[model samples]
Target: MPDTTLSNCVRDAATQAAGLPRRRSVPVSLIAAVAALGGLLFGYDTGIISAALLFIGDTFALDDTVKQIVTAAIVAGALVGCLAAGP
Candidate 1:
């Protein structure tokens, strides 16, 4: 069997010699705040259209078919955008 304790000691010594910081410099709170802001913006962007569509439909005097088409167009645009940003 391999000498696990010896291997661990060597690994720790190598890491210490490399002069890398063992602790994180950036705060976790800052990372969480940024992530939360992104989520809020994404939620607002996807949800605002539904609320605005009511006023838009009334102002334009749009029928159900046209209103559906407008909503579908927004969804299709989002789908295309997501596809374009694929991993």
Candidate 2:
């Protein structure tokens, strides 16, 4: 029979030679910047829409009920998106 210690050493050496590949990691600063930019854009878009709501109501002669519905639609869309992006 082959020597047990010698066989073990050969297996360990083979494993070392076939070592797992190293993984590349994303930088924290880059991730933080991307997240910040996304937040900025979302806030900007919401603000612009809110500001334009007045003009839209005036141009379309929308009543208070219709205006509320339009605002609710935006909130509903955001809720759906939040739900879809689960943790």
Candidate 3:
């Protein structure tokens, strides 16, 4: 339960709703364009990672510990990205 109520969201007189965000949505074309770009980037990244990991694993002859290190590094990078974008 929230102890403090959020009041930053204000409804205009035109709408009867209060204490809630107004219903809003981005345009479908804009949303679809962003989604398409994100999907493309995701596919490209996964493909690159698959190829890179083969060389990376062989170069390190990675033990479980080293594999963990690589995984942790990627996780840390994602966390930093989230922190940068968060409110």
RMSD of each: 9.3, 13.8, 10.3
Please give the CA lDDT of all the candidate structures. 0.81, 0.80, 0.68
Q: What's the C-alpha lDDT at position 24 in model 2?
A: 34
State which candidate, 2 or 3, has the greater TM-score. Answer: 2
Best by TM-score: 2
All candidates in order of lDDT, best leading: 1, 2, 3
- Candidate 2 residue 5 Cα shift, in angstroms, is 56
Tens digit of per-residue lDDT, candidate 3, span 1-87: 533434422334335554545566679778898989977975686567667777888897877677667766765876798699897
Give lDDT tens digits, candidate 1, residues 1-87.
755798677876777999864454477878888889978976787688888888999999998899889888987987898799897
Off by over 4 Å in 1: 1-43
Lowest summed lDDT window (length 10), candidate 2: 20-29
Question: Lowest-scoring 10 consecutive residues by lDDT in candidate 3?
Answer: 5-14
TM-score, candidate number 1: 0.47
